[model samples]
Target: MKKLFQTSSLVSVLNVSDYTVALTWYSAWLSKPDETPMDGMAEWRIADNAWLQLDATAETVKPSAAIIGVNDLAACRTVLLEAGIAVGEIQDWEVVLSCDLHDLDGNKISLAQIISQQ
Candidate 1:
């Protein structure tokens, strides 16, 4: 298997210092960003080639994490707490049913829901 440059798209970047408060909390927690090609960056096309970039780093030095894989983690945490986003509460992590979030430069998001009969 020697194919290393044929891959197309797959972005997963999460680095924000302050691009207008991370574009207003990732555009209401990953909503209005189908594309924003430049100017601090914000793109979300999490499928066909996969993407989820929200990069605007003047460079800090800590707090950075990401884990998003949700089918229905309590209805996406109730639509990210009704667009006010402070989502964290849906534990029971035996396999996967998790929740934890922290934006506003504290970047430590997680939203998992994968317990399909295993």
Candidate 2:
């Protein structure tokens, strides 16, 4: 039997009614205002080489969307907060400091900084 595959990439899908504002807000966090927009969505290259996709629609995804691991969780949270976004409390996830936040479209995302090897 074929073995289950490993997840090579994580994608955060944000469904927004106004794609323009959504893209603008995310672009600020990314500090890549010059980056070209993708199809009907904007793709952000998060730390660890993951992708963040902002979609324009009314679709609602489960709150358990994604929890991404970053190199510096505190710094990421600071950057996001400085950009006027709400940064949730950080939880001790054993080996990581995990924090949760939502996108403009309300898709939940968790940001975690690993503190030890799993």
**Top model number, TM-score:** 2
C-alpha lDDT values of all predictions: 0.81, 0.71
The residue ranges of model 2 lying beyond 4 angstroms of the native Cα positions read 1-10, 33-39, 47-49, 57-64
Residues 1-118 of candidate 1 have per-residue lDDT tens digits of 8987787876878888777777777777666899889988888886788777887854653667878788899998998898778887899877889899888778787888888874
Clashing pairs in 2: none
lDDT of 2 by residue, 1-118 (tens): 9759866776666666677876776666666533346556767776565677766644654333677778888888888888788879878978779988876667677888879774
lDDT of 1 at 98: 88
lDDT of 1 at 50: 76
- Using lDDT as the measure, which candidate wins? 1
Error of 1 at 56 (Å): 8.0
Which lDDT value does model 1 have at 56?
84
